[model samples]
Target: MKLVLAIAPDRFRDEELFVPQKAFADAGVETVIASTKTGTCEGMLGGAAEATTTFVEVAPEAYDGIVIAGGIGSQDFLWGNNDLIRLVQTFAKDGKVVAAICLSPVVLARAGVLKGKSATVFNSPASVSEIRRGGATLTDRDVVVDGKVVTANGPFASKAFAASVLSVLSPISP
Candidate 1:
C-alpha cells in the first residue's frame, strides 16, 4: 500500500520520520514525503529529508494511510495548516489509516478527526490540552490505537507507533 508522510519544513523529529519510513519501506509500502513546500525538510537533530511534494499536492484518495511527523515545527508550521487538516479529515472519513507521532497528534486533533477517539501525544501540557480540547480521550501510553487512527506519545515510541500503523495497513492472521 502507498502512504503519505507529512513533515514540517523544519524541526520535524528525525526518528519520528525515519523509523516509520524504514518500516514501511521494509514492508514494501510506497511513501510520498510531503511538506508545506517541495524540497528538503530539516529535522530538529540535523537530519534532513527531501519532501517529494507539497501538502497541497497530496491526494487523499491515492494513498492508503497518512502519517504526520512531529516536533516543534509541527506547532509552527502544521498546527494551523488547513490543507493538512483537511487531508487528515478526508483520510479518516474514507476509513484510511491515520497516524501521528509526538506533537503531531495535535494536528489530527485540530483537524477534528480525534474527537471522541482515544489518542496519545508527547507528554507536554500544551500537547495534552490540544488533544483534550479537540474532544479526544487522552492516554499516557506509549501508543494508542483507536480504529484506523494510531497515535504515539513521543520519539521513544516510534517503533511501536510504526508497528501499529503497519498492522492496520497489513494485518497479520492468527
Candidate 2:
C-alpha cells in the first residue's frame, strides 16, 4: 500500500483535509496526519483532527508523498515554517508526490519545488506574488499538476486534488 503524509494548520479548511483523506483511504492508501505540533487541531469550520505527529518528527523517506491543506491559519503558521518548507523540499528532491490545496501551495512555492512548473493556488495577491517569485507559472484552473507537484485552487478542488495525488503515487491500488 502507498503511504502519504497530510499536513494541516491548526485552522485548516475542513473539506481540504477530510475530503482528500477519505479519497486516500478509499484508494487503500495510508495517510498520517502531521502538524506543527501533535494533538487535536481544529478546522476552520469547527471540525477537529488529531495530528499523529509533528512536522519535525516525520521522516520523508517513509512516505510516498505529502498533502498540505490550507486555510487562514496556514498564513499564520505554515507559510513561513522552515521545518515544513524543508520537508517539502525533501519530498521533492526524493521525487515523491508533493501536493497542496488552496493557500498551502505557497508553502511548496517557498520550498522552491514549483519553479518553472505550472501550478495554481487560491487567488490572492499575496499567493500569486509568492508563487511567481518562486518561478511558478500560475494557471487558471481548479487543479494543476506539474510533474509530481499537484496544486489546487481551494477547498472546492479537494477531491480532484486527491485524485491527482493518487495518480502520481506509484503502485497505487484501485
Give each model's whole-structure lDDT: 0.93, 0.88
Q: Give each model a TM-score.
A: 0.96, 0.95
TM-score of 2: 0.95
Q: In candidate 1, which residue pairs clash?
A: none
Model 2 spans with C-alpha error above 4 angstroms: 2-4, 172-174
Report the C-alpha displacement of residue 102, candidate 1, in angstroms.
0.4
Best by lDDT: 1
Give lDDT tens digits, candidate 2, residues 1-174. 455455565779999999989999999898899899888999999999999888998998778888999998888889999999999999899888999999999999999999999999999999999999999999999999889999999998988998998888885233
The clash count of every prediction, one per candidate, is 0, 0
lDDT tens digits, residue span 1-174, model 1: 899999999999999999999999998999999999999899999999999898898988788989999899999999899999999999999889999999999999999999999999998888989999999999889999999999998899999999999998853122
Off by over 4 Å in 1: 170-174
